[model samples]
Target: MADTTGPISTLPGAHHSVPAGVMCDDHPDRPATHRVQGETDSFGCELIDMCDECHGEWKAYRDTPQGGVCDWCGKHADKLRPRRDYEEGMYGRVYDVCVPCITRANQEAEEELERSGWYD
Candidate 1:
């Protein structure tokens, strides 16, 4: 039988237990909301964004820079290729691939299309 559980979210790693404070930017007492960011304020101690992950100020910290260490998903790894491709689509700009995901995806697609009677 399939396990019926609560809804799964893309955003994992939720630590909402703020210590007794509004949170100083560089408080050693504060735990960083972004585990993978390795972020720090002007000071040496870790910085706490409104959303430590996204830096949404009102909700969390707002409009954070992309390419920050994404603690949310493991989409990125150490071997990320340097170049990327962009394309115009029905929904605006879309990523064709980032070289690596492209290579893997292309190979998979080719094999899928090559199945018996697929091209026939």
Candidate 2:
């Protein structure tokens, strides 16, 4: 299996994109500033356009008492890294997730694919 233990930016694959002038699906009142990427979807991907306040709240919510942490695990880290590829898709970018979490997520994704007979 390919290395699933690297930053999301290091992983090669397509990301999500939405239409322009789209409002935050979560908050229709606010203009979408962040494109939140979720699992891969059939009709494009599960992309969400989030407002700045929502995005900031999301980051704060994902953070630990010590400092910012991985998007997956809540473990505290000195610094978080962004997935550049996913980030550059539209405007909103991938949250600063940690390497370990990225690796684990990739591993889980690979395992899921294997279970689903994606390789077979």
Let me know the TM-score candidate 2 reaches against the reference structure.
0.36
Tell me the tens digit of each residue's lDDT in model 2 across 1-120: 011122233221232344567787668877776665543322233455668887788668556443476665778877665543332443333555777777766788688889999899
lDDT of 1 by residue, 49-94 (tens): 3325233432332233234222223365433322222232222222
Clashes of each: 12, 1
Q: Score every model by TM-score.
A: 0.24, 0.36
lDDT of 2: 0.55
Best-performing candidate as measured by lDDT: 2
How close is each model in CA RMSD to the real structure?
14.4, 13.0
Score each candidate by Cα lDDT.
0.33, 0.55
